[model samples]
Target: MTSLPQQTDKKLGLVIDLDICVGCHACVVSCKEWNTGGYGAALSDQDPYGDHVSGSWLNRVHSYEAGEGANARVVHFPKSCLHCDDAPCVTVCPTGASYKRSEDGIVLVNEDRCIGCGLCAWACPYGAREMDVAEGVMKKCTLCVDRIYNDNIPEEDRVPACVRSCPANARHFGDLADPGSEVSLMVLARGGFDLMPEQGTKPVNKYLPPRERPAEPSSCGKRSASERESTADATGFFRWLDQALERMG
Candidate 1:
């Protein structure tokens, strides 16, 4: 069997900013659109407008509620293939179709070799793998490999479509192997945490910490931008005045 690329101990992956994510589902929708229409066949939709409507999606967004009482908060977690370092899906594959890359640390599928047994899907805990009904093969996000390498596409737009369409700019794509990369920097600065680290998959992707709100009461009711600015300016003026009086005394 051909070995998957494991270059220089560097793994490429995504670092998602949970603080900026609004749970808009834009990433989910765009991912569906691109994967459905790209080199991969349309992502299998089991039932449309039916009672049990669920389909194969490489990515899915989950909204979670946590904490108790005053400290409680809602977090929107977008789940997808972690492309784990120890991918069970690859080991379980009867064919060598599912494999990881040594050069870039990307997990990819060989659609031509897949038998459509769905065994790989069962092995994945993150539910990152998907089966293409049309092609009778399993499919998952290639991280837009075709587009990312296409010379025709612009350099700036080489990243995945989901990363491009995100209005909140919460998604980032780069080589995790490079410690100084932007994704790595943001991960360190914002304290990005992995999901299910105990599983020992060592997922390439990371999620930023949830926003921390202060204990102070939030401003209620409608207030114009100008009014809010005026209030802020007055507050600053009063603070400066107090400081000056203290110095004089």
Candidate 2:
């Protein structure tokens, strides 16, 4: 069995804002693109473009409809490794392949030491770990460890690929343990929460809850003639015309 670090100097992790994630899957694509070639084994897609296509991915976005009527909205949740402080996956590894870094608190797998055992996957509560069938090894998010500490890359571009490629700027990365860090402040201000605190994993990543929507008509009722017209204005010409007409009238 593997043992965890006593403590880490910096708790490097991500702070995700649920309010602005548009379910674009940009993070997912960017994560796969970078990790496939940069670190670990290549993420393989079995029978791609076929009916039963399946592939290994480090990040995934899930859509959920919340509330009802006027408050109903789709919540796009982006999930990956949390790099827990007390990582169950690490402790469950028989060969010591799974370990948490005492330097940065990043949980990682040593592919060479791994015996293609699925114990890590079963131990993780977040469903963050995935097994690469082709390689016969378990794979997971490394938090872009290769990119963050690399002196080769520019300092400004050291964040994880998902954080850099998020179209809505919904993802943030930093040392979460530092109270003055941007990620920590964001988490504090937004009342960020853990996914499954009850499990006692103590995940490093935090998620900002969705903002409250203004009280208004339900989606069914809100689609008035003007709203329909606005939707029909593919290029916003009619929208501008309507605005101008309203200003004049």
Candidate 3:
């Protein structure tokens, strides 16, 4: 089994704002495109136009409803490899294929060393690892490691593909190790939190909770009675896809 580094030099991660995320799925599509083409093995689709279709995807957003009445909301939860400091996936790798980088704290799989055993996926608490059925290896988010430090791309476009493609500007990437970093400050301001604190993974990525809905209508504008009564059900990322695919069938 593999072991984790005592510490990493920098904690590079993401901050997702749940309040503004429209559940558009721009991030998910962007991630699939970039990872398949730019970084690792291709993300293959099994029976894409047929039935029981499944394939590899590094990132996924699961939207679910929480709370009640005026306080209720459809939260868009984007999830991926958190690159936990005490990454269970890394420690459970018998072949030592899954490892965390000491420099940036990014958890990654060395495909050459991987045996296609699926142990890392089982060990992961976030369900972030994906099996490449075509290539017989595990794949995951690398935080666009190749793009972040590349001199070829424009400075403004160097962020992870998901962060770059989000139309609402809901995704942010930065060094979380620095207290003064923009991501850290955003966490402090928004009361960002871990996915499952009880797991003790210490995931680097933080999520800003969705703000509570106002009880009274906004004074600046008025809404039709029809709009007021309407509710958004499963309009979030993964659920939307599930509903769309079901309609096709």
Per-residue lDDT over 92-175 for candidate 1, one digit per residue giving the tens place of the 0 to 100 score: 888898898776667888888888999988988888887777678998878777767778988888888778888999899987
Query: Each prediction's Cα lDDT score?
Result: 0.79, 0.92, 0.88
Q: Which stretches of candidate 3 lie over 4 Å from their true place?
A: 216-249
Cα RMSD, each candidate: 7.2, 6.3, 12.4
**TM agreement with the true structure for every prediction:** 0.82, 0.87, 0.85
lDDT of 3 by residue, 125-202 (tens): 889998899999999999999889988999998999999999999999999999999999999999999988899999
lDDT of 2 by residue, 116-209 (tens): 8799999999999999999988899999999899899999789999999998999999999999999999999999999899999999999999
Which regions of candidate 2 are displaced past 4 Å? 217-249
Question: Model 3 compared with the native: what TM-score?
Answer: 0.85
Ranking by TM-score: 2, 3, 1
- Clash count for candidate 3 is 0
Residue pairs with clashing backbones, model 3 = none
Q: How far in Å is the alpha carbon of 75 misplaced in model 3?
A: 0.9
Q: Which residue pairs clash in candidate 2?
A: none
Q: Which of candidates 2 and 3 reaches a greater TM-score?
A: 2
